[model samples]
Target chain A: MTHLVSIENVDMRYGGASGTLAVAGLTFKVDKGEFAAVVGPSGCGKSTLMRLVTGLHIPQAGHVIVAGQHVTEPVSIVGMAFQNPSMLPWRTTLDNILLPLEIVERHRKRLRAHKAEYVEKAEHLLDVVGLKGFGSKYPWQLSGGMQQRANLCRALIHEPQLLMLDEPFGALDAFTREELWCVIRDLHAAQDVTIVLVTHDLREAVFLADKVLVMSARPGRVLREHRVPFARPRDLEITYDKAFNDVVHQLHGEIASARRAA
Target chain B: MSAVIEDIQKSEPARPLIARIDWVRASPWLYTIALFAIWEASVRFFDLPYTVLPAPSRIFAAFYQYWSPIWKNSLQTLYTTTLGFLMAVVGGLALGLFIGWSKVIYAGLYPLMIGFNAVPKVAVVPILVIWFGIGAIPAMLTAFLISFFPIVVNVATGLATIEPETEDVLRALGARKLDIMLKVGIPRSMPYFFGSLKVAITLAFVGSVVSETVASNYGLGNLMSSAQSQFNVPLVFAGLLALAVEGIVMYSIMAWVERRMTGWAHRSTMSH
Candidate 1:
């Protein structure tokens, strides 16, 4: 299988007033249609790594290449979701989902004349995300879990080849989080898009991702990449499986080690 | 949990057919009546001099009696104020976006803008009168000077305060700089724009009035000045009342338009 996204020798540093690097010496890659998750303690630059692959931040050193192209600026072929979801309050759930289509080029020219067709597509996505009959409802009218579901749909609406999740389920409750893990699981299973998730939940990482990448604190580095030997079309019950728990326990210990080393 | 419970417990605050309204339901006329009762009583008991202040009843009569003159002067003032305000809106939005969009422009022009805005605009009334020679030009210039700052300040501040994640979302979608400006920058700034318009239109009225006070002899400002000289305080009070009403009317119109434009933003915030 070919790599859909690649980050090579990437170093990102946010300059402090006293002159210091924030996160340094990071490198990673996601193969086509793979669900990859990065797990670490907070401020470990997991988000920085996500930004790098999503073309939101340019690396100070090395390269970020996606689909055989170097990312000097932002690339439109990627979709992104964050912990906050941050849907524009002014727009309806359906309109928010179409936000990228209004911005990216190929979709822009088609938006006006084919608006109804695109709107139907957005409706279908909302339905798949368990938000059917909610396309016209405003963002403020939805619960946090529902809003995050809409956010997931919005990220997927443009159907980008690469999907980036920056702790996308961080704020939800345990139940809702697991529920969304299934939603995301199904989303990726159906779309087969490459997913890069930055997460703190070891169970979540193990349960959803094809491979899990562990990162150290501060100057984040890819300390380990564990390929899940578990079978896919993973049901929620798989989270309770001994093998699944074993992988989660193994990743958890690796993160504890990474934190102490940092 | 509490929120969900609250939603359930308070669900039937009103009946079902009303389409699930939560915040406000009573007719605003109740508040209006309360205000008027207080005003009517205060004037009756205070025994205020008619020259200094008139009773609501007297003001009502004045409202009716001077209707034609008031209307005429208002037309004149409106002409000046609207032209000036339009100019301000155009100039301010353009300058604000240009300054906001570029770091160099922001660095070069922002401080100077602050400095210019800080000067007391009323001082320019005399200079405007002297330069433009009254009638409508001076009044329009004064209105322009007064109304332009809020728009510039609000628009610049709005552009400056864009949410970082939204920018990130747009970037991954490969939005060009201009696309961000039109989609994100402009729409995000609209609340600021509408907020400024509320004050700007009022200032436009004030600017026109100041111009009338300094130079024009036929506007509402001039009519009030003449009424003051003749000790016809009721008419002066009436003029002020008329001005206030006009300001409210214009503000309401602008507000309605803003509500329509920013309905999306408003809806999202309300849910949270």
Candidate 2:
């Protein structure tokens, strides 16, 4: 299996030399087209790792290679969503989704000449996320769940090879979160893309990810890796299965110990 | 979902527009008329001297008597104020964008701008007269100087406050600094820019009148000063009335422009 993203012995610190260390000697690899989840204690550097891989921050030590190139600057091949939807109030849903095409150089040059095609593409993504006919509405007009659905469409509009989600569903209620989990599952099944999800929910990790990596607290590094043996197209009903509960419980124990060790 | 939709519907006005009384819109005119009525009644009951406080009726009579000079001076004041305000709009926007573009420029220039704004613009009029030598130029320059500060401050604030997450979304796509400014920063600053215009227009009127009083040969300010020296108190009151009308008209125009340009910034309730 070929790896699309590889981080080796990475060390990242905020501020300068005397600054707080966020991650130390962190190493991981995500296979091409795989759904990988990183879970740990609350203060663990899962978000820091996301930033490092996306080239938003440079590690003080070691390497981050993505798509066969060193990530020294912000890379163009990745799509990112965060806990906050943070949609621009001035833009409609379709315009917001088309923002990346207006910025990414490959699409920007051709965006004007082929405007209709891009609009069609954006509309299609909105439909897939169950936001059909909502393209003209301003973001503030939408509910929280609907805005997040639009955010997901915006992330996927550029058809990026790698999707980085930093607690995308962390702010949703339990039912809404579960509904989105199915949306993400279907999206993953349909798209030929690699995903790296940073989440705190162990069941979410066990259900949506092909592999789960557990990390230690604060100056975080991967402590253990677990392969999810569940079959694809897994149902939410499996969450009640004893075997699924066992895996979630085992990961829960690992996180509890990791927090205590801090 | 049905409950949320119902709540939104409940919040909306159910009555037709013509059937409802818009008290908020009518209150200003009502209050102004009531104030004039009270002033007129008190003046007549007391048999007050016209020089001390002319009745609104006497003021209007004087307005009819001196309509020619009053109309000319009013036009002059309006012209100087408008010219000065247009200059401020262009200059303030450029300076604001320049200052907000980088931290170094913002730090270096902000204190100086605050200091310059602190000095009384009325005091600057005499200096302006010394340089420009008593005409519309002094009045115009004073208007420009006095009115530009609010625009600069508001525009800079708008640019400075772009959400960090929004910027990250753009930067992660390999967007350059110019791209970020064009795509988000400028549009984000628009509501602030329009809001400042209403304030700046009123201040521009103040600047023009103050400079005209001390340094110019024309404008309502000069006419009022001359009328006062001759004890033509009704004419002076007429000049005040003209200034008041001009001020209200200019302010209303600015407010209308603000709404037209940046309606997106206002919520539906506020917009209505």
Candidate 3:
């Protein structure tokens, strides 16, 4: 199987020489078109890993390769969403989604000449995220869940090869979070894009990912990797299935132990 | 959800043009009239000398008696204030962007800016007078000097406070610094820029009046200073009243412009 993203024996540290080690000798590979989730105890550098893969920060040691290219600077083929859903309050929903297009050189040059076409593409992504007809509304006008949905649409608008979600649903209420899970599930299935989701919620990891990787506490490295054997097009009902709960419970236990080991 | 949209719309119902009295709109006028009435009553009952504290009637009569000079000085003050404020808008915006462009510049310039802002601008008027000589030029320069700091501070603040997550979203896509500024930084700072105008305009008026009181041959400040020497207390009050009216009008205009340009920033119901 072809690997879309690979982080090999990486070490990341913040500040200067006396800085804290966030991750060390960390390694993971995500296959093309796979849904991968990284779950760990709090402050285990899950967010640092996401940053490394996206080329926003270079690992102090070792390699982070995405789409077979070494990440030396920020790569242009990734899309990212964070927990805050930090939508620009000034831009309308559709305009917000189109923001990336105005930045990525491939689209930025053509966006003005082909404005309507790009706008249509953005509107379609919004529609798929269950936010149809709300494109013209400002972000503040929407509920938190709706703003997150717009955030997701913005991440997808550029048709990125890899999608990185950093606790995207962490701020939502339980019902809204589950609803967004289905939204993401449908999006992954429809777009055929590789996804790397970093989350703390074990059930979220089990329900959404094709493979779940658990990491140790601070100065983290992958402690274990578990393949989710569930079939494609999994339903929310499967979350209550005994086998599904077993996987979640197992991951929970691994994380609990990791926290204890810290 | 549709319910949220409905809630927003329902909260802001359209009012008829000839609806019953809007208490909020009428309050300022009612309070002002009441204040004047109380002042008039107090002056009459206490038999206070008009020279010490002029009655509203005497101030109005002085306003009519010296209408020509009052109008001319008022125009002069307005001219200097508006011109100085416009220069501040342009200069402050440029300097703010330059300061906000990098961490090094922000760190290097911030202390200097704070120190400059700390010195009383009234002191600067004399230095301006020495350089440019007395009159509207010194007054205008003082106005510009006094008003630009708030704009610089506010605009830089707006730029500096951009969410890191928002910046990351663009950086992941290989956005250049200019692209980030155009798409995010400049637009994000617009509300701050416009909001500062109201404050800067008011400060600009103070600046011009101070300079005028010190050096200028014209302006309401000069008129009031001259009237005080003559013991024409009512005329001095007339000049004060004219300055207050001009200040209110200018502030209102800035407020209206802010609402028109950056309405997106005011998301709270209280803003309405």
Candidate 4:
């Protein structure tokens, strides 16, 4: 199967830290409709990976090919959600969710004509995220979880074929994080879009990923990859199963080794 | 936080008998009535000479007596101030956006702004008179000078304060530079913009008053100056009161605009 995204020997380095490398010799590809997670310790360039995939950062060394095009600058085809959610404080919930559409083409052209339809779309997404009747409310009025849900909905609103999540649910409580994981899972399943989730949570990886790619500690490199064998339409209960624990333990061991190697 | 407002509200009625407690709660009418009562009583109680101070009743009588000329003068001042203030808004918004959006220009012009602003706006009215001459021009420029800085400062702050992550999000969404400016920068900075507008309005009023004090043959400020020169103290007091009333009316109009523009803020006040 043709991969939706192909990473060819990628290397990334931010100009800030003197002679420090964020990621090196990293290579991975996500197949069409696949859900992949990159797990690592703190400061392991997990965010850098997201930037690389989203075309926000150009690789110093190999190529990043997404949807059959080589990445040079930021791309519109990818939808992204950051850990902070970072919704605009001034805009209403619906307005904030429609932020991408306001800037993106085709939608911008069609916006004046199909404004009501778009509003209906945003409202439906809000409803699906359990935020019905909050379309008029600003970001500050909502709880952290609600904002994060809105963030996810915003990322998915344009229905980009590739979704990039950089620790999107890291700030939420355990319950809220799990709740968002289900929300994301349902979204990915319902749409069959490819997702690249960069997370530190092994349980999160095990719970939602089709394949989890483990990266080393600083100067992150893809050290190993594991295919999670759980059936489609994953539930919170499956995480308690022995197979889940086995995979988690194995991934935990790999992370421990990666940390020791550092 | 919510409890604080509720507690104050609940406590408002409990101790009712102590000198018309509910009267204070009815702040709108109570404020004006109390002010006029104290004003009239103070003049009467001290038996201060009428030339030094006039009773509120006398001022009211003077207000009616000079209704046409006084109203015309007031209108002229209002027109000049409003003109100057609008120019300031446009200039402030344009120059402010320019200076604010660019770090280099901010560095280039910020110090100059500081220096110019340091010189009291009124101090420059004589120069404005030299440049624009007498009548509306000088008065309008004075108002413009008075009010311009706050808007520029506030608008610049508003324009420049876009969150880094938001900029990043827009970039990732492939938004053009213009798109970022119009979509993210402008609307995001509205609250700060309104804040500046309020400050500018007051400054504009100050401008008109100062300008009229110097050059204008018309305007409420000119009327006040004439009253002061003629030593008609009650008329002077009446002009001052008229200015106060005008200021309140102007403030209320702007405040209403603020309310309409930012209705989402009503959610906060709704709990009250």
Please give the distance, in angstroms, between residue B106's alpha carbon in candidate 3 and its true position after superposition: 1.1
Segments of candidate 1 deviating more than 4 angstroms = A16-19, A110-123, B1-68
Docking quality category of candidate 4 according to DockQ thresholds: acceptable
Clashes of each: 3, 0, 0, 0
Instruction: Provide the lDDT at B52 for model 3.
Output: 96
Candidate 3 lDDT over A1-262, as tens digits, reads: 8899999999999997689999999999999999999999999999999899989999889999999999999998999999999888888988899989989989989999999999889888988999999999988888899999999999998899999999999999999999999999999999979999999888899889999999999999999999999998999999999999999998988899999999
- Alpha carbon lDDT at B262, candidate 4: 62
Which docking category, incorrect, acceptable, medium or high, applies to candidate 3? medium
Q: How far is candidate 4 from the true structure (C-alpha RMSD, Å)?
A: 5.1
Q: Report the lDDT of model 4 for residue A53.
A: 80
Sort order, lDDT high to low: 3, 2, 4, 1
Which of the two, 1 or 4, has more DockQ?
1
lDDT of 4: 0.85
**lDDT agreement with native, every candidate:** 0.84, 0.92, 0.92, 0.85
| Listed models, DockQ each | 0.53, 0.48, 0.65, 0.42
TM-score computed on alpha carbons, candidate 4: 0.84
Those runs of model 3 whose alpha carbons end farther than 4 Å from true positions after fitting are B1-20, B268-272
- Highest TM-score model number: 3
Model 4, span A98-217: residue lDDT tens:
989988886888888898998999999888888899999888788889998888789888888899988888888999888888988988887868999988899999899999999998
Backbone clash total for model 2 is 0
Give interface RMSD, every candidate, in order. 1.9, 2.1, 1.8, 2.8
